[model samples]
Target: MNDFVTVAVFDYPHEITVLKHLLDQAEIDYFFENETMMNIAPMYSQALGGIRLKVHPEDAETVREILKKLNDESNLKIV
Candidate 1:
């Protein structure tokens, strides 16, 4: 089994959704933490440290690279 590690944390649902779509398209396995809690209590997003995006340790570098490329292309900071 692949051990997962957090690649990024996002306070907004839309941010997570955008990254999720990109990761999905890249076919990189991933999951999110604190999504339910954040959805249930959005105000706690900051206190709870936001939603976390996790990926297999082996995919960590690739995930970072992908995010970097996307951020560069869009000229938006994601990480």
Candidate 2:
């Protein structure tokens, strides 16, 4: 995980619902930092720098492309 880098940061847990499914479908290696805490207390999202979408460095570009597609296809964009 030390080599993993943040690909994105979502402000709320709900925003990541579809994203999670998408990542799974794409078979991408990734994890959401602060996801559990955000689920417990959404207000702390900003304080914790939101829920970080961390991925292996090799997978970063792929994850970013997926994120871009998701954002392009949905009205609710992920930060």
Candidate 3:
């Protein structure tokens, strides 16, 4: 069984896209919950707690570090 953990939550599609790209580049496996739901009805994103990025528990720390580095380099924040 894969133990996944939420690393971040984003309300915007573009933000999720960017983070997915970073995770891909670093070869970190991840999945986003509520992405389809958010796409279907953006207004519900807030109520649904936004889109959640999940990763293996073992990769959670690495994912966070990568996100932080990307944010720092781009002067953008992903939460």
Q: Give the TM-score of candidate 1.
A: 0.82
The candidate that wins on TM-score is 2
Q: What is the lDDT of residue 37 in candidate 3?
A: 92
Query: Residues 18-62, candidate 3, lDDT per residue (tens digit)?
Result: 777778888888899999999899999889999999999999899
Identify the superior model by lDDT, candidate 1 or candidate 2. 2
Q: List the residue pairs that clash in candidate 1.
A: none
Candidate 1 error regions (>4 Å): 73-79
lDDT of each: 0.84, 0.89, 0.83
Sort the predicted structures by TM-score, highest score first: 2, 3, 1
Tens-digit per-residue lDDT, 1-79, candidate 1:
2479988888867677677788899899988889988878899999989998889999999999987876786677654
> Per-residue alpha-carbon lDDT of model 2 for 1-79, expressed as tens digits?
8889998998988888988998899898889999999999999989999999999998899888887888785566545
lDDT value for model 2: 0.89
Off by over 4 Å in 3: 73-79
Better of 1 and 3 by TM-score: 3
TM-score of model number 2: 0.88
Clashes of 1: 0
